[model samples]
Target: MKKLLIAVAALAAFAAAPHSASAGPCGLPNQTTLWIDFADGSVPHWEMFAKPGVIGAAANFIYPPRLRAAGAKTVYFDLNFRNRIGTPSDPEDAATVVDRAHRLFDYAAASMDCPTPWIALNELFGAGTATPWSATNAQYRANVLAFVRTLAARGGRPFLLVNSKPYTGGEAGDWWREVGKVADIVREVYFPAPSIHKQGAVLGSRSMRQGLRRAAADFLAIGIPPSRLGIMLGFQTTPRTGGREGLQPANAWFRVAKLTALASKQVSGELGLATVWSWGWGAWSDGERDPDKAAAACVWLWARDTSLCDGPKAAGPGFNTSLTEAQITLPRSVQCMVGAQRIGQYDLARLTAMTRDRDVAYSALFARAAESERVRISSERILAAERNVILLRFGGSTSAYRGALARAGASEQVGRGVLADELRRAEIKRTFQVPQPSGTEIAAYYATYSAALARSVEATPAAPWLGGAKRGVALASIAPPQVFKLPTGRRTAVRWFDGIYRVRPLGAPKVLGSIPLAQASGPISIALKQFARTNAFQSWTITQQKAALRRARCARDELPHVAEVELASYLPFLAID
Candidate 1:
């Protein structure tokens, strides 16, 4: 290894003649940087950095020329060193640091169109070693600063990494400010993966953002400008092997990953900091290995700027639930976010499904809202009692319930609100005031619509031995109502009672004409009951809901462009399937 290092140094010296560095691909001060650590020459997720959204990737240990050859723009050489080079009395120690940096720069320049300006000097201060303020580390501090300054003197932008804040007073703060003048000062801020996937509201993930903001504030308080500051987030493991449980159940992790990008973007835009850097894509220790790193990286890219790549598709509920290529538009409402709970286009789409006319949809929305309010007022105690029963169905595991809810695009609060609406609708049906049709009325109705009532069933051979034969089965032979709702010519995967064949509708269903009163009585009775309840529910609430709508003050804005988004953060708890 020593011989190899010496040979590389000799080669670097031969290539050290200064050449004008070419312009890098990334336009800085706006775009983020994806700094990944690889265990070996082989990059498992090479496709992640094969584009131009980020400021290019800062790689560790991987040969710069190899990465560039793979079509990745290698922008930074990530060097991990945690201690001073030599004793204070060693005159060659400071010179050694400069010489090493030059050799690395030359080696990187050999493969690039231009020399990379960025060099991430990672973890220069060891954990619990002499603090920046400690007198015991004066020489240590001087050597580190010399390394940073030397890199800067050669037109290189070196970012110094510290495990944590290493200062106690303004004196150390002054020192950091001096270092910041020449190089970026970054800190590693990591949270256990399990914490991000916790149950309930997104408080855990929100707390993570809050932690970042607070850390940034601390640096700013110590006189470091945001331009010279950065933070590194750790994505080190999957839940299975790491000592610290990583993000789990896939959906929750993806949600957090996307949110983390948004949160970091918010902080950077608000605070003017250098971009956040990502770490832990390598096959390192158990705590630093993530199997889903590729997907996570894609999500991060998509969240920052959609032009980079289509994000991972998440299967959930509501209109446009497929997120693989969802083009999100802002929720179109003046008061969308003004309520106790934010209203989204998802809710608007549900209302639209109920009715096509805007007025009718608004009426239905108000009716449901009023019913929800009434349920909350009159049946709060009952619902509260059912909460435990509902939890018991998930084996009392809040995490499982939350994970299930996340997959369904609902949080516990939304789930409970839906439950209340369901209960109110059920009660309305139970207490419906419609009188049953008289025997004469039933007979006349059956005679008029019998042909429309007849169910249609087209049969397809279930076994290969049947030679793929298909035939229309007699309507009378099959049971009623099962195939009644099947659309015309729509093939259904459902099997028949004997499982001998699958069925579909060969033609639109027609009423059973001239059927016996006995056979027609059951179908007629069911149809009447369903019609009465539906009519009564709509009419009964329309007038009262119109009055409520006047006071509701909902936005007059039209529905937003239909799109789907990951709902893990929004609906953290949903009923288990």
Candidate 2:
């Protein structure tokens, strides 16, 4: 009986061996698990939903000390220093900043003393900063190196945050190699811009699949093992020049799925851990709020067990064979689709269905890019609207000129017209209220009027026209027709506009107002409006006019118009006048 049982068992094992090996382990797929680095000190209420056993947190650099004390699992230290260094007042400030940052790190490490890993050493200053690496400034670099050496020496393994821009490659690579000599893991923080245009044509143009491939290659070149490296998805609100804004939060999950799918295609089996750019700080008005909720949703979607090895893993039929051959096999059971239905639930079947849905990937990419485009267009429209207002105020076109005054409201226009009439009356009265000038004077005045009228018609909305017209009228009223001398020692040939003097420079054949001066560049070139103010002549001068031009440029570049106008009052007399 025992011999018969053994024979039966052996037969059973032989028959099941092939099928059992083919079934694989727990249907586990070659998917990347999502982790979040909640850089903001505060945690959001929504984080409670993250997969209870798998979720990890990266506390803010300054606030992590408290978080560690509170028994948080992971803490991230910002390795770089903040505060301005080498400013005019503090040439030695860079050294001080570095020292302070190091001391802070040491204090945190000493206090925590836990065996749990220190996940990220978030080095600050990316492409936007003047300093690419701490080493760009020798003293600062030395301090950072010391801190890095300490981390390497300790049992803690740290990953460095890197920017998308390639500008810091040399410094980053050098640091990585030098540090790797001692550190157990030298991982990188990758923030690839989602949209092709935002990332610029070169990086973004690559298909999600292609981008991941390149990222893998780039990482390998930098000496990071495929297993050790991780990718971070960022949630940025601002759009590029041609991008949109306010993307649906759901789209964030879709993007992650797409990136993960691509990453899976590049590497065989389970790729290393993945992290979202943030967790928490979602409730705070600034930074990404609801990050916890978003992160929870992403992890719930990605944690499903499915294989990527069962399906025919080609990049499709006629594509680059080299690229195709590199494609990683995917399991038909793995779901990559994302939608409203499966957002919060961590159920297995629903997740698999979402991941496999091809439409979800396409829709997600489209929506994210559209949101980015909307932001870009809206910003441009606002800027154009402001330029339109400025042009109307300065250009001498009757339409724009009238429109500007009208927009200023009825009271402002009425006051300006009344003041101009009073000035005209005063001038006529000073000449004994004469009904008419002598025939010779009349001909000269008429000629001046013709020239002035021409200039008024030809004037572009700009500062020079306003200032020139005011000065010409003043000179014409006080001096003889053709040979009036300006207060600035320049001679003017006069013309008249409704009996007011208009002047032109003598040497320049072109009418003075019509002659485009090099100095009169940009939208609102002269201080015409200032000349209309009380004590007009005294208030408007070359120096004052030039200052106004500068202010206009500065205002357009900096503050919005409403704020600019109010701030204008505080500017130097030259700018305001």
Candidate 3:
């Protein structure tokens, strides 16, 4: 009889395993918390379906015994949210806000049989802080502080820092802003934009490793340690692409192991918890389009090489291949085929059948490069949406924006109008300290910002090829040598690169190396044919450098489920390598 152990978590719990997510940190902690997000973060209503023991939605909540075995001490439930259209400041409005929050708390309490829920509110900056809203900055800050204090009495952990453009709230920008005064665990969002056009690319060029680095830097600068901070990264974008909302690009699973691996060395040790944005749904969310494929990847990311030997053995061809290779028909396909990215000798019949029936992988990189594209086809759209929201609220002649303000007990948009008025006064009185440019100037200022936003959206595949993913394809063909030796005359040495491994020449800048997609983990290997120096550090770089295109193009089927507590709740999602 096979002894089986499974672990899986819902959207919210930050799983902190004792050092391992495929030889790193992606494996969730033994004790997992169930989180419910109120935003439309790519996946909608994931909690209702991510229950433990559920099939299609496998890797639900963890079983109590396994958690106890891990010697975990606590169980948690948290609700994630942002302000309700900017916190109301008036006594009447404030009362209504408090009442509504109470009702939500009551509903959450009744809905789940868990402990007292914690609250995580994003964009904690007052209304005046970020956008030109009706509330004054002081009023906005006071309201947020008050509301948070109220929730703190009932276990609320607000997102004290957020990465909003032009403006930010919470601890990162909280210099004298004082948002941390009313907080208990402050979380920060470190999202990577998916615009990969300058080089041979597919999704956003920003790597998971880079995002975490930036996250760590931000916290470090603010004197905040990882113990008090939580990082929120996304497995997929919210379809804010091409000025259209609700687009699912299925940008493969880029860095599950690598991210965990890097987090182990970089930021994971001190962090209280790390979370992926969603559990997603249906057969379209990145690498999770297929249950079996996703499950296979989940197991690998969760337990690394252990999963390869822990099973009844995969019953299929290419047993030596990794789980991703075993599943993808094309040797280097990275995502499901939505449209033909190649025109040459393709296994059309196989491709066709797979496209219609299964979650197949194709090269979004090849297509984007050929189409003069880089990574992140939707990054611009996300920015545009933000700009559009601001413009619509302040400049657009829309009924919804007007009605929203009117309902907020104001005939005009007090926040937007007042801010604009202040800017105008500043321009007029240099000594009196009033801003210049009233009506036309204010409208024009926003118009220019809006135009820039549009230009970004129109700037599809951003720049020219940068000689990496494009000129580097042939380099990948160099078959991987042994872990420590070169093959015969082959000068190339291969090492896996999920952005976690090193990718540079030792002691010298002239040594040449290339990283192309290996069947599963694309490694960065160098050929120091004549220049191989003694004591030159057998391997080159070890830290995740720039975001690699190959990283975004491989479907790591053996990666773990993003739903934090998932992997442990069910049988290993997949037992294949």
Candidate 4:
């Protein structure tokens, strides 16, 4: 009988081994998407937009080549259609204005290319505010569809953006209903706090959810599938405010997460693309700005965690929740002496490069670094000087001729002075020597390094998964046919045995009769024993036996005999099946 039991165990072990040996599940793929607007009436600081890592946590960018150079894979060009809208001053001029609008649309369509399979149609003029809300509704819809058709002609999906607040009495619902027919996906930009006065309003609040639901219902009503809708989660930072204002202190980060999760859940059960309005806005002064602060915030909010709501709880209800712990602690780290010095040196070098003549070697060095790194020279004064140099060397009607020449003449002197100052401030310079590690130590180090790198890349900004040196068994996939039978004419269900033995089959099952085991008196111990053991009963340790017996004694009335059967027979089944 023992030999027969061993054979049964061996069969189970073989069945389970294949499943247990499988590799870990693949980590979440990058789903985060970002959009920035650079096609307004005036171009923003183009140099700033060009900086490396300046794209923040955005996976996509929406600007011209100048702005898209910041490493974003997708660029959505803002077709500033509002500029073309007008009432002809004379009756004859009306046709000319209309003709001009058509030409502009054709020109823009020809000029741009969608970087990815999906290209967004930025409806800059669709909001009701631009044209009279009632009179322009049909016109707005037609205009947007024209652009979308053009995009489709070039083999790209159309993305539409709409204001969150009611536009000319038409809220998101109305806009969605009107444009839903043409757009492949609809994105709504929600600003919880329209003004500072409205701060602390529940953004992803119960009301917000209701509003979204209403908008969604309208879309559904208009035959727009829920799968095609996305919301652009963001907070507005005005020049008056310091850090991101309108963020609920308690729920700032949580709100962002909740909304992201909610939108993802609502849209397609997938976190659709999101963009933080403008990464470099807020209190960015040329000299005092820390670009990484904004970038870190962007990363923290968007790609840090897959689910926003799954993260740590906010401090309290109705409390501001957007400000993350990282954001709170940022003020302290923002002033890092060494880091700040490096940034300042980089900025100074950029300034010097821009001011110097383009023909000079030093100018080339600075321009190369700035262009390569995408660092924006924030100071208009510096940009002006650089322009002057470009004009002087290149000649023609250029912006800043004299300043570039003056900086070029003094480039060597300034470069030397800056280099000397930096070297003098270096506090510690040392070379360390150590004996080579043994093979075992070397193998362990490599393993540790690989694990750390994997975790770092996989870690979400929202809630990072941490690891340590302690040995702990990872819960792998649960085996199939989790139910089992014993020799005592009884059946039992198997489940993970931590401190408690959680039955896999929650209720009565057809095949397996209940076991007579009692609840575990204390933590139930389990481990992978020798593969040679035929019957798992032989591999069951004394502790496991004792715990099984204790749990059997306390088996509930509903499952009276669930503990008596020897669970050891099922040990091989514990291997992920």
Candidate 5:
């Protein structure tokens, strides 16, 4: 009868194993592997899994015997000596890993209940780190294969823990298939508490189950059998402890445990799968909270093979489960949509004005190439000029300019209108009877605009007019019909053209020799006159722009939906002042 049972077991194992060129079954029974970190025997609620004849595995070597003693059927040690082997391809490191494996196997072999422990050689290729994994590294692959074969030779079970999922193609596929042959592979899955809560209870649970199912399918696709595959669920807390607020509140913990059990069953099917590892239950580090009594209760409810946990479930009175994904995606009402549309239009107009102002400032400061002298311009002409300036500033691409306006919630028409008003105001300033600029103002303007005058002369040599004052010319020529038309010894600003000049009757024209104007540079008198005109125009332009803005009508009614939008928004409630 014993021989027949052995034959039946062998048949079952064969049936569960995948018929592929990969690792055969590691023969680990379906069990929970709890990774406990505290060595001082602060169990962190390990006794919850201590039901009579409850077979389980533990990652840390210190507590397997104690778990067995506490009424567990049989507990196996999952030795975790991570990264002790430096440069896995190195001969010395590979030897060191094998030596440690031997010692661990010997230690587990001494325990009566766990003669052959499942030793995790080490976790490699963590997905959350900057380290990149390459299966193409032949030496590393050879080292891993050698390590697992060595353990199997010693009659010990070896498994590998990895957070990163491996792809199945070319050399990568070859590596996973090779590793899956001798050892079990477990993947770690973690979901932050906030993320779970954001989805609500039911969907969160469903999402987690889907994640596990997908992982199992991925491994299966790479020719790994369900019997040899395993999963490790992370329950860590605090960022320092490598967790994003894991399973906070009593109910969240209960919900995760319940869903995890269901997911495990679905993934493992009927086979005795490797193990479901529970990581991060240790309080060894600061900010790491150990599992509490409620957590232990939930684990007990899930682990025990009894009908005792039906009475006090996590879903009690006042627990809300009505919120769902469907409810979250309900379309907005027509009224609200209309209100938002109106608000958006209002915002666009404001943005258009702002963009226009910015373009105007940019053009004034840097885009001097397109600027030309114009004493005055009509509203339509000014509008076209502003639009042209904006287009030129944005690389002459209408689409780019439109895209910028759209991003700022502005329309091109409104921007042009605002700029037209600005130009009109500047033109209007020239008509003002402004007093002559002081000598101090002229000197300051000369210092600030000497470079500009040089560039202008270089660009248009014929217009030796350095901002309205023509060099080496009779003062009488500065009369009507010229760029700067002003009476003798009298100054006026040409705000529209950004030029201000005063006539200076320095006597009648005379043939002062055939000297080039470049060589016969004008005296300080011509330069000072140019400086005065520029200073007056600039100062008056600034004063008028401010006055126009102050005097401009800003109708609150322009934004019909502003109050409605504010009502629809969170801005009012968020104000601290």
Candidate 6:
């Protein structure tokens, strides 16, 4: 933590702060606000909170049965007064959102005896690189201030949150201080540390909280008070029913809850007001059909008991052994005070080093010697991906960069970051080689096309998984099932055959677990053989396995040999009976 440029005097107080565990959940108080990401979902299912907590709705136009229920508490409505990524210059449209948010707040307050009623705004922070409403960071900050002032003029509680880097779009004003005036609290949500995961050193499910802690230090250094900031516990990796997705450790929910509590402590000085982003997204994009329930239950764990979320004091000796070099950026705690914030020219170099160092750590778990050099080049690639993401957000852009991202496997966060970094450097180098006009053209090409290229690299299933048998080989070749290695962590995989999946300990024959076709989603293939005649069935799957069993009735000739299976995710294996 070498740098002290951001705020020297104020941060000096943090020098002696001990890293002891908190006695309980950071005591964030009534600040826990629930959320309904979109208005189009089912009747806001507040039951999942299972206990008393805030329920936030992004576009809850009308009051509902739950709000009227006895003992119902706080319900926040996130404002969508205007198109967040649409035209940036229109102050009127932005004003409309402020006005509407106020109205929504008033209606809820008036309709029920709710204890706390507030309005929040998020996601207007556009996707990709642009700021809210597709405006520059400065413009976005001003717009937010404008909205805040509007709400303050009439006066109830109004808050603002964005899912971007700390202080990204809001620094145009006094940033921390000015916005703090009108906002109930100014907030930026930090979700999964895909960056940490990309580093591969954060380790186990518990370490994901490391990103939140780092981001918290950054936020504090920049002047956002602990009382005002919040972190939304989000999933960087989507959950699926089969393959690597299903292999997610069962303790995932516990890790998230504990991290949420740990992260809450990071920002809350004595004020004890760290907010955990909750409420839920409308539905899972992958289309898993878990009827009567929202397909993705990712955010469900945020409202749990905070006491259990704390990481225990080292029970004994080995607790601190595996700390990765990338975990702590600078040597001393004071240096990190300033080290956390990336200001001015220091932003690029500092961030690049940090990003590259982390990826190098991840390389140990995921990369081989032959690819080590290319892996080291991750810093440049990520910078390019960043630039490309920004350009892709430019007006008139469609999914033009999708093809390139596919080529680079950069659609994922880690890939997108590397490609964005690479494109940025290329633009700088090109500016010196050609005329300004030509360089500008080249820069555009790099930003747009290069980003897609990065996405393609990550999306490349084969890079993550060495080549394995694609389809069935003769059963005779394997009198007994042969041993094959399986990658671990998110990349770890297993193979599905017939109705059984063979999961092993990497290369060992010891079976770790078994996943039958009954629990799988999507499709499977099969074949049934009776006597001299054999019939191949492409559509046979778990859904039909039971009925087939009933008809066969287990008679000798009637019993048919089961054959074939479907495989997904990047599991390493050979085809088998």
Which has the greatest lDDT?
A: 1
Q: 8-94 in candidate 2: lDDT tens per residue?
A: 233222221111111112121224433444534344532332223223344444444444444333444443333322321222333
**Sequence-dependent TM-score of model 6:** 0.38
Q: Deviation in angstroms for 272 in model 3? A: 5.9
All-Cα superposition RMSD per candidate: 21.9, 25.1, 30.5, 33.2, 18.7, 26.4
Model 3, residue 467: displacement in angstroms?
38
Position 232, candidate 3: lDDT: 42
To one decimal, what is the Cα RMSD in angstroms of model 5 from the true structure? 18.7
- Please report the candidate that would top TM-score against the real structure: 1
Q: Which candidate do you rate higher for TM-score, 3 or 5?
A: 5
- Across residues 1-577, which tens digit of lDDT does each residue of candidate 6 receive? 0121122212221222112112111121334232222222342343433233333343344433343342224435554545532223443443344455456556645543332344565544531233232334334444555555545444344566654554334333245455555453434443443333333332322243444545555556656556555555443233532111322232433233333433343333223444555433344454322232221232233323322112223112222222222132232222111112211223223332433442332221111111121223445444443443434232224354444444433243433433432333223222222212233443443333321211000111221011122222111112122213333212323322211223222222222112222311000111111100111222222223333322221111112233222210111111122
Sort by TM-score, top down from the best: 1, 5, 6, 2, 3, 4
Native-referenced Cα lDDT, model 2: 0.33
How well is each residue in 185-233 modelled by candidate 1, as lDDT tens digits? Answer: 7777766656655622234444555667777776788777776788877
Question: Relative to the true structure, how large is the alpha-carbon lDDT of every model?
Answer: 0.51, 0.33, 0.29, 0.31, 0.44, 0.33
Q: lDDT per residue, candidate 5, 134-158, as tens digits?
A: 3323334445555565555565566
Candidate order by lDDT, highest to lowest? 1, 5, 2, 6, 4, 3
Which candidate, 3 or 4, would have the higher lDDT against the true structure? 4
Off by over 4 Å in 2: 1-36, 39-43, 49-51, 60-72, 77-102, 105-119, 126-140, 167-173, 182-206, 238-245, 248-328, 331-577
lDDT of 4 by residue, 396-454 (tens): 34433333334444342343332222221111000112233344553443333322211
